[model samples]
Each structure stands twice: as C-alpha cells, then as structure tokens.
Target: MSATEDPAAETADDFPAAPPLPWRLDGSARLGVFTLAQPMEAPSTVTAVAARRLLVFANSYRGGDVSYDALGVATLARHRHRVAVVPRHLWVDDPSIRRAGREQASTPSDPGSFAWSDSSARIASGQASVELSWHVRTRLALPMPMTFTYFVWDDGRLGCIPIPGRATGSPITMRINHWPDHFPELAAYESSLALRLNFAMTVRPQRLIDSK
Candidate 1:
C-alpha cells in the first residue's frame, strides 16, 4: 500500500466541501477469495487471486438515526497502479450513506436489503443475493492498523482517498453459497481470510488524481 497521499489530488474536486473531513466508523468485515477473471488491469502480466468482501455496521448513529450499512465489495488486484480499489464502493444497504458517499468519495452504490444472525448473514441486491453461514474459530485476535488507498470515479475524474484506521481482527471460516450466473466475479468460496472486527477510523478527505 502507498504510505502517503499525493498533494495534487489531495485538495481537488468537491472533497474540500464534503459533509465532514473524516467519518468515524466501527464495523466488522469478511474477506473472501475468488477466481481471477481474465483481462485484469494489466494485459501483459499474469496474475491470480481476487477478493470479495462483506462488511456490517451495527450502529453508526452519530446523528441519532440507526442506519445499518452493509456492503458487498469487489477488491480487484490493481497490478501496479498507485491508487487501489477498496471495499464499500460496490453494494450498500443505506440510501443516506449512498448519497453522502457519492459526494465525498466518488462511490457508486446499489440498493441493499439485509438479514443476519450471530452465525449467518444475507445481503440481497436487485435480483441476486449472497448467503453466508460460518462456524468460526477465532484463532487470532489483535489490534490491527489498516492503511489503503482507494481510487474512485465521478463523471470522468478519478478520485482517491487514503483510509487509515485501527481495529482488533478476529479471523473466521465462512461458507458462502451463491449462484454462479449471478456472481461470476466471485467463485464458490467456502473460506478465505475472513475477519470480524471492531474498528474506528476517521475517513480522510478525497483526492481527484491526474490521469497522466
């Protein structure tokens, strides 16, 4: 991951006028591995392995409205790109959060519906849904720091942001069941590097990068 942000992309676009400088969020996430689809970011280099992620925010009511934010993400390998794609840009449950995300981070969103239990969860999209059930054995639990750069798109401008945070990661084994036709991006994955986390981070201001 890139350790620092580009000064040029730092203060560009409408990010300076976003709802807030940084949003403090705490949640749990599951990262799953899938088959690498052909024609990746780079044509010359051969690569394998891809990531699909699921995240849930039980409570994010800084303003006093209980909004459950659940997201489905496709974390594609960026080859050698400086700006990487991270989670929370694919599918989301809350419309309010969607509106804020579009302006703040250049995120494209899908309407979501969710249901969950202690051991199982489901996130429903338009016509497709993802069902996850896990019998998890927490082998490790430690304070972890997260650092990643996200590249997003708005109109024609490519936006970027660095999200740095701290969390306690509890890894798990999850069984995911889905139709192949619906989610071709992710293969039928029973387990991968999955984590249940309690995290807190102040989201950084967005940056619009120079294409050339």
Candidate 2:
C-alpha cells in the first residue's frame, strides 16, 4: 500500500478479531523468513551534514539467535523522509497486531496511541546530538520503551542507535513478518539481512529534495 493511503481503510473488522491478549510462541518453533522487495533510496535532499541529524528506531523479536531474530518494526522521521516499518508498533502493540504471539504494555492509557519527546545538544566538536524517546502501547498497559540517539558530524555522517528497555524479550528469531506497507523497499532490505548483526545505515542524497 502507498504511504499516503488512509490507515482507516484497514480496520479491525477487516481482519478476524484478535486471537487473544497475550499470544505466545513455542520456544522450539522455527521462526519464519523474509526478503526485501527492493533497496531503500535516500531522499535527494539529505546531505552529509543533514544525514547526521537523522534518527532511526527499530524493534526486533527474539526467537532463537540474536543474529537471526526477526525485526518487528522500525521507524525513521527526518526532514526529508517519514517512514514506518510495520507501523502497528507506532499505533498498536497487541500480540495479535503481528501474530508474533508476544505482547507489550500500553501507554497513554489508550489502546492504539503513543506519546514521545525529543531533545538535542551541541557537542564539543560543534556537532549536534539528538535523542528521541518513542513509546508504544503493549499488553502490559505500559509503554514499551525504545530510545534512539543520533550524533551528527561536520563531515556529514549520522549515527543511529537503538536502546530497548529491560522487559524487552529476545534471542533473535530467524523469520520476520508483517512488513510495513509504507516502506516495502526497507522491508526487502531487512528480509535479506535475516542474520542478526549491529550496523549503521548511511544515506547520501544526490539531491536535496524530490519535487515529485
């Protein structure tokens, strides 16, 4: 689906009623697999300097091995790009949302809403450091917390990092599911990199913006 599509078009009634509150996966079951549909293209406007200001937040499910765990969702919002992978994490956190069988607590006391805040600072090297606290609703009725820190440098590089809370469960699962329709290209990349590994994504824009 296009990112501009109305989310309301896919309502709860469209799918079977959520199976249950807290879905559970068998400890020994084999996780599923996914492949990226395409490569992600950097926005034309993203410069080396602006790239440093970019931030990304992602959440993955632990099934068997950390390297092969399936990525549940990932989100990035910059001056040029606003993307959500498996946006359910941005709007809802029920186990039934993705059929992963795991549930998180809720936040804002709303079943399908979230709250967030951002802060920035100037470092000694004259670069800017930014941080974002993104909370998602979960079965615990509490926020499943994910923090992201971004460091931008004069040379034009951005560092994106994710720090998940303690309650976050794990051992990465091999298969990833529920790829967000808004970012089919990114989904394809994630699917191809099924193995668990920590790496930074760098984007160099040829143009500052796409008029299209």
Candidate 3:
C-alpha cells in the first residue's frame, strides 16, 4: 500500500509485487549530461528478486518525439527505497515484458523506437533508511521533457550523476528522482537554466554479466 502507491494505481484488493535482488553487479550501465550535448546512454538491464528491483534503458530525444529506448524497467520490491510517484506514460501491457522494436533486447536485429514520454517510480521510508525515486517526462520542450534518476545505496552502489543546466533551445523542467525514501524531499529540480555540470560513473572494470 506504500512504495508511493502506483502499481498501476493498484486495485482488485491489490496484491502483486516482486522484482529486485541481484547484487555484485548483475546489471548496470549509465550516462547522463547537462550542457555539452551527447551523453544520454543508459542501461541497468535487470535486477529482479528483491534487492529492491531495478531496470533502465534510455535513448530519448524529446524535442521532436524521437525515442529509441524500447526497454526501461523499474521495481524495488523492498529493502526500503520508498516514496513512489512518477507516472505520466509508461505502457506496453506488461505481458511478462518482451516487445522488441525499440530497445532492450540487445541484438536480434535491434529495432526499438517509440516517442513521447513521462515516467515514474517511487518509494520512501525511514527509521533506519530506504528510498527510491525516478522520473521521466517528454515533449522535448515547448511544453514537456524527460530525464532519469536512480539512488539506491546501503551498499548496492548507485548515487552520483546529477546534471541539470542546458541551452540548445531552452525550455526545461527537469527533476531526476532518487531513492532512500525520496530524500531531501524530492531531490533535483529546475525550471530555467544556469549551466554548471561535470559527471562520471565508472564500473567497466570488466563487464559481460547477464543472467537470463
């Protein structure tokens, strides 16, 4: 009944929740930018079983409706990371998730692309600790936009990239969410621009880990 309450707004008495639990790096790949243009790479493939779920994929270009990230999943089954709420548009009918045409299935001809965005994920808690928040909105500017955020730690590794400052056709409203109970009261926010960014998140020491 909490986790920011939105498992499709839960109904029918609500009872269905599972995803998260895969540590030591089972899935993770990220990239983000603020004002130099060219840094939107993404991947956090899957970590379902209860380490508080996680799944991400990005390739969006909000300004003209050009999306190519056919794979974006999020689930934080437990272990804190609470305070959820970020749903504007995120659908494909679940069906155990397997719709290749945009992005998620690494190869097999790679053809995944869908435009328009607005996404959410939330969970918050305290007394010891727990937090999770995610946001993505799109219209590309002139009315809407999109970006991502992830913050899950207590040892699972994550929390650093926070870029917000742009100018390439300004008109922004970015808010990348983070977990640990939606810390500092909904982290990251901006309306205009002020420009000041420098980012890095490295963990490629030797990657090739995937558990199908």
Candidate 4:
C-alpha cells in the first residue's frame, strides 16, 4: 500500500487538526486609536541560541506569553539593540463603552510579544538566517500563524527590518487584527494619528552593551 494508505506508515498522531474559533464577529469590529511611542533601545551580544533560550525562559516565567521578550532578544541578537515601541494614548469613536481595560490587557507587553514556537536556521550568501513562527490566539482560541525572519551578516551586523506579515498589513488590517470585534476604524485612525504625532514608528535596532 502507498504511504498515504498504509496504516502503520501513516503517522496520524503526528499531524493533529487545528482548533475552531471561539467567537465570531457580530458587527464591524471597533477600532481604537493608539500612538506608537519612541523606540526603546538597549545593547547586547546575543546569538540565535541565546535568543531562543531567553524566549523559552521568559515565556515559562511570564505567563506563557513571551512575544515581546523574544522580539527583544531577536532584535538584540541580530542588531545588537533591544527596542520597544510603547503606545502613548488610545481612543475609540464610540464613547458608550470604555475599552481601556481590555485594550491594555490585550496589548503586547513588548514590541515582539508574539511567542514564536517553530524555528529553522540556515546559512546563505555568507549570512546566517533564522525563521520563526508562532500560533497566535485570535478571537476564537483559533491559531493564527505569524512569522518573522532574521539575518546576521559576516561582520556580525544583524538585520532588524520588520518584514510584512499577516498582522503587519496596511493600517486598516493591522488595527483590525489588533482590535478585533471592536472599533477597528478607530484603530486605523489612531495609526494615522500616531504618524502625525511624529511617533518613532519604525522598528530600529539598538546597540547591545558588553556583558563583560
């Protein structure tokens, strides 16, 4: 029998089905406006191995949510800089309900807050690269996949540019995913407001300090 048909050869336990969504959107999601604060930078000499270990440790200790910590480690490892972008203010169009509590509770504690689980490393063109993925929990405990790729050059310089992903789309989509089931329009507007506020919106790598 073919591998597909062979029961012993088939590994049913290896491949599990995905979970279903917990809730569905009743109406257009609300959007909250938020201003991206200045990029916080720190110095480090972290490697891919170190970054992975740091993420593992942070996630274990920090409520199983180490997205931001991973981002910090990745940033530092690749760019020698640890950075964070804080939201200054947030607002919603509908004043009827106060979403501040929910917003704050949902906001990522760090810039790279999505806990990436799977990682693959490779070397190409004289540079070392690592790709990472995370199963994001959205509206319904459903797993929304997210990914990031980092590269390190021969001279030890790390690339810190933010690559486009499912959550890093245009302002509208970005807000939609961030504030699902809420005022997404307001969130889009807030993104624009952040730009107007001269928020250091770009993700920049900071220099790492020598531990020694």
Pick by TM-score: 3 or 4, better one: 3
Error of 4 at 53 (Å): 7.5
Off by over 4 Å in 3: 1-49, 56-58, 61-68, 74-113, 117-212
If scored against the real structure, what TM-score would every candidate get? 0.71, 0.24, 0.19, 0.17
Question: What lDDT would each prediction earn against the true structure?
Answer: 0.53, 0.25, 0.25, 0.22
Model 1, span 1-212: residue lDDT tens: 11112223323342333355476665666554444344223112212223333222222223312234564544443534563654432555655565566656766566567777887777776676767776668657889886666666556565567778777877777676653243434433665456666666666878866443
Question: Which model, 1 or 4, shows the larger lDDT?
Answer: 1
lDDT of 3 by residue, 83-127 (tens): 221111123322222122111221111122233333322221223
> Whose TM-score is greatest here?
1
Q: Judged by TM-score relative to the true structure, which candidate is superior, 2 or 4?
A: 2
Candidate order by TM-score, highest to lowest?
Answer: 1, 2, 3, 4
Sort by lDDT, top down from the best: 1, 2, 3, 4
Those runs of model 4 whose alpha carbons end farther than 4 Å from true positions after fitting are 1-53, 56-139, 142-151, 167-212
Candidate 2's displacement at residue 123, Å, is 40
Q: How large is the C-alpha RMSD of every model relative to the true structure?
A: 8.2, 18.1, 15.6, 20.9
Model 1 alpha-carbon miss at residue 170, Å: 1.8
Q: Which residue segments of model 2 deviate by more than 4 Å?
A: 1-37, 47-147, 150-170, 177-212
**Candidate of highest lDDT:** 1
User: What is the Cα-based TM-score of model 1?
Assistant: 0.71
- Quote the lDDT for 156 in model 4: 40
lDDT of 2 by residue, 40-147 (tens): 334233323222121123323333221112212222334334221211223233324422111111111112222222211111101211122222222232222222
